[model samples]
Target: MKYTFSILAVILSSTKILIAQTDSLPSNSIVLQPVEIKQYFNKQSILELTNSAHTLSSSTINSQSPTSLTSALNTVAGIRMEERSPGSYRLSMRGSLIRSPFGIRNTKVYIDEIPFTDAGGNTYLNLLDPQSLESIQILKGPDGSLFGANSGGVIRISPQGFDSANDEISLQVLGGSFGLFQQNLGINKKVNDRYQFAFNQSYLNSDGYRENAAFERKSFQTAHQFNYNPKGQLKLFAFYTDLGYQTPGGLTLAQYEENPKSARPAAGPNPSAVEQKAAIYNKTFFSGLGHDYQISSKLSHYIGVFGSYTDFENPFITNYEFRTEKNLGLRTFLSYQNNDLSLPFQFQFGMEGIKGWNKINNYDNNKGVMGNPQANDLLANQQMNLFSRTQLDITKNWVLEGSLGLNKNSIRYETLYPLESQSEGNIKFDNVWMPRLATSYQINNLMALRASISKGYSTPTLAEVRSSDNTINTDLLAEDGINYEIGYKLQGRNKNWLVDLAVYQFEMENGIVRRLNESGVEYYSNAGEMNQKGVELSYWSSWNINTKFLNSIQFNAAITYNHYRFGQYSNANNDFSNNKITSVPDWTMSNSLYLILAKQFQLNITHNHTSSIPLDDANTVFAPKYDLIQARLNWSNSIEKLRTKYTLFVGIDNLLNQKYSLGNDINAFGGRFFNAASLRNAYAGAIISL
Candidate 1:
């Protein structure tokens, strides 16, 4: 395997030199660089965008493998991972409010220009194979002129693909604290100058830190690219993922204080009181094709088309009630670039459509007594959106970008029980439009200033608008919002240091809030206007020193401050003037440091802190602030003769074993608390590349 890779590498290098010589331009003349075929693992250009964006390189991602993507991203500043169970994770930025625990994340997640989040705009990070990823780009703010829908922001993941000149294979096995285990294999091959293929597969399992918090997942990804000529390129890629997990139901404050390790049993005398022994299963598959065409020396065009489907099921502790959801979607985009314009300009347009079906069923003998209480109501929905954006270089050092989008949603509810009202069984939401604009000015070679203002909206979901019981009205309007932001970026000292600062304010009209009706069944309703304002700061620096034993030291830190309030509320039954919004923290911060030592070794340390937050609208329960720390050591070596390399890494998370709750929420069984802001965890892993 190693010899083959070496041979392929040699051939590719030689071919590249020959092509360069053949395409060489005249001496003293400016020459245009030839375009190379796109690869899944290529580094994304973070600095090319005028919007605030951050890129996590492959070097950093590789060091944190065999860990959840959520865990890895939590290290970033202004980013938070809110998780209720192994299968459910939410990525929040700048103190954004999280609406759900499952698949349709309010924040958009993407992979190589493809949307990974479901139709509802939610994403499941656990399902993604971290080993196959090359880099992660996080775009903050509503500058969706290039990307479409749910563009409050975007989390873009890039994968590793075949190198036309190289044949390579790699393997990895990892084990850690809490009975955790993982294995992965990858291969890349160049069939010829015109074709290349890559394959990757991985499996992971873990018995979580908290009792009954266990999970297992498997994933497969493949890519193939065809180069027809120098001016045109086409690539096809597909991915499939399977996930299963059990959740340790969050404990009440009393239960946590009594015995943090004691978990509710899966099967007990009272199913409602026991920990949830749930079976969660999901399968996602998607394929995409893209083409790039150079129309002329001054003009270029590109187009992409994709189709995808997702199916998921969750069975609760009662083993009688279960929920299943299926999604199918199609997306297409076209873009044109022109360098001949007065200033460089790009225009893009796209269309997206999705259909979703969801059902709740009863399998046990228990009737309305337990499980499938809402079995009578099933939902089918469809949504369509059209979007467009334009970007122009307004001046030598200033750029302007703008985007517009329109969306329409329709839903149909089927009722099995006659007692359920027809009004709650059929619903249609109004179409909404969003527009955003942003501008950036380069103050100098090392500093830039940026500002953006955008409008965003969240439509009501079937479950949010309709209920099994007819007590609540489903005619409430959709939630609408507007966001404004201003920020700056600085890179100094030969690019060894980088800093990003941003402040934002958001206002929501008719925001959706879950309310308990007279009969005690919780239902969703439009709440009064609300506002959230926050600031974020991130900094990173690397110092190289010539010393006897030390090579370099790197430090990074991120901090956020949020203020939330109700802008308007009028309830005839009660005075809610002093009510506090639920689940939002006032302050959050994270920091990390790395030291390069002698030999092939390195050390890392990290810390995170979050302020107290409310549990419910009434503000009766409060979760206090907490701190967590982690440490890691890594070593690597290469075998030149065999053209292979190996790396070994050991890590300890929550070195202090701090007992803290990162998130909590009201639940059907009881108000639940999420545990382990930092878990005392250890892991060791090795990667072998041939």
Candidate 2:
């Protein structure tokens, strides 16, 4: 730790002291500018922001293959994105994956200001096409200040829509090893001053490395804005997605080394993954409407309404599960500012509510087909969050902010088949108030420091309450935690270098954890308590010495080191007090380099390293550390005669073809823990913009 910090300090000092580079200037060259962050209630420049946040711009997202977000997202510190298979994504923020088996949990995701997470507290991150993303803003730590009830963190996604000034169209097509094929089309137009629209369509298919691990997706999305008055605008966002993916069960260590690409085979009395045709099928349609109104110079009103319906099916080794889910939500807020107070202040208050209805059924899995009925159930889940914030400028260079949210969650479920003791009931949680106190001080234009203390509360999702064990467990407790964080941001000479540092400690209670039954079906239980602490650092540099040798250079490096321990934790079978957390690596690092050559050619290379992780609470088994390397090269130029621009690119992943598991099933019953990720693969693609 000491060595790392010393090296980082040396880099910072040298960058700030070094003489600014000089280069021949182009008359029409683009200049760098300050980027504003909108994740909070107010807009602030990146340098002065109080919270720890990272933004993945379109330029960064486009540097990798268009197949998935795995490569682009890993560049951010304190985040791990894993693809168990194509179209099946699991995200871990703060290195906590205790409750998630598949999909995203403990975190909140918003798409174009719409709540894509729904009322279930689960995020189907793979449903959206990667090509449709424009930017992603990640807010780290437990912050329930404005967004609502969450413990892990928050992710705000701005899709390819929302840009009103873009008047062009773009298309992309890519194919690669492992039977990968993808196509994307994007169009945006500003039709006069009162109307604008954007549309995106994508098709993706991949035959994954493992047997029976095939995936396909078709997605269409659109956004429109109407200006009814000079001070008001109404926006509409909608999307339809049809997705199918095969879920190859985990493989044992022996199987992984013998045949890395083979699916899970039968164990003792269980069937093989191929025999049961394990997979997931989902079809969904979602839409949202938002209105922004400026009532006067000092006040504004904003409201958003969203709804989604889903048809989901999952054929697992234990059962064939099917569900129909409907969700509706509304978010509205009012902002008022006043300079009359002793300190200039801004105040915002809002209310958010979401309700979801899920009709779930489980049938016997007979060679991928449904057989006798097992369990039938219906559940209605609702969540309400009322939030308020007050921001005061104590001085020209200092800010103080306080925010709070009151949340309440409830679930009602009924069992229609296989009557049980707890056939029907309502479980409600008392209203809890989560508050945040934050302050930031900008010492100068080049350096700033900030600190925050916040409370977090998260209710278990429907899936966790009624897990695949085919039983409803209302005894499950909600998870709550408190986080203390401090951060520093710096910009070096000529603003060519930037650094971000954050340190935090979180203490949580009643942490939800996953458990498995004899049949390999999953259930949920609450671990007593947990203690987590971590440090995250990010460095970025851009050299302006543009020349034919190296027209431009962009470099980014991120690192995370965390220590987690179980606090007063015990289970029915074992006492796991003071043990290490499961599936959390001790340290992770990612680095990327981008070089523009001769103005029209570019090369990008990235490397990622993750340390070994304990596979269970007992800390008896661990997954070894691994390193990954990926690179891409592209050339782009304009066809002035046709008013168009084009780019051709090729990339390869897992350059060393190292065998590793991207996602692991912690505490597997039969030690079937690892899922082999794809080996060395290559892809090529082209994009035309007009």
- Top TM-score model: 2
Q: TM-score of every model?
A: 0.85, 0.96
Among residues 3 or more apart in sequence or in different chains, the pairs in candidate 2 whose N, CA or C atoms overlap within 3 Å are none
Per-residue lDDT tens digits of candidate 1, residues 1-690? 232244335434433333323222222111111111121112212233455676665556655435666556776656777666555665666434434433342456766666666554446577778777766777766533334345256677767763344477989899988788989998888877888877889999887766666778889998777888978878777888888776555677777776665554323233532334555677777767767666765445555566566665555544444455666666665666666768987776777667777665544324123443444456777777788877788876787878787877777776554455433455667776778888888777777888888875666655455432333345767666788888887764245556678888878777666555443345666666768787877766555543667666666666777777666664556554445566677777766677777777777787777787776665677788767777778887899999998889898877877777654544223554544333687889998989
For model 2, give the RMSD to the true fold: 2.2
lDDT of 2 at 557: 82
User: lDDT at 294 for candidate 2?
Assistant: 91
Off by over 4 Å in 1: 1-48, 95-98, 143-151, 162-167, 190-194, 265-276, 297-302, 317-324, 359-378, 416-426, 461-473, 514-523, 569-580, 667-669, 674-678
The sequence of per-residue lDDT tens digits that candidate 2 reaches over residues 1-690 is 443565467566646543375443232222222367785766787776778898887778878767888888898999988887888888988847777778787788887667889898878788887778778889998777687778888998887657547888999999999899999999988888888888999999999989989999999999888898989989898999999999888887888889979999988877999999999999999999999999988899999999999999988888899999999999999999887767899999998899999999999999899999899999999999899998899998898889999998999999998865338899897788999999999989888999999987888888899898988988999889899999999886467667899999999988988888777778888897889999999887766556557676666788899898889877776889988889888888887888777767889899888888887778898888888999999988899999999999999999988789988887777888888899999999999999
Give candidate 1's whole-model lDDT.
Answer: 0.63
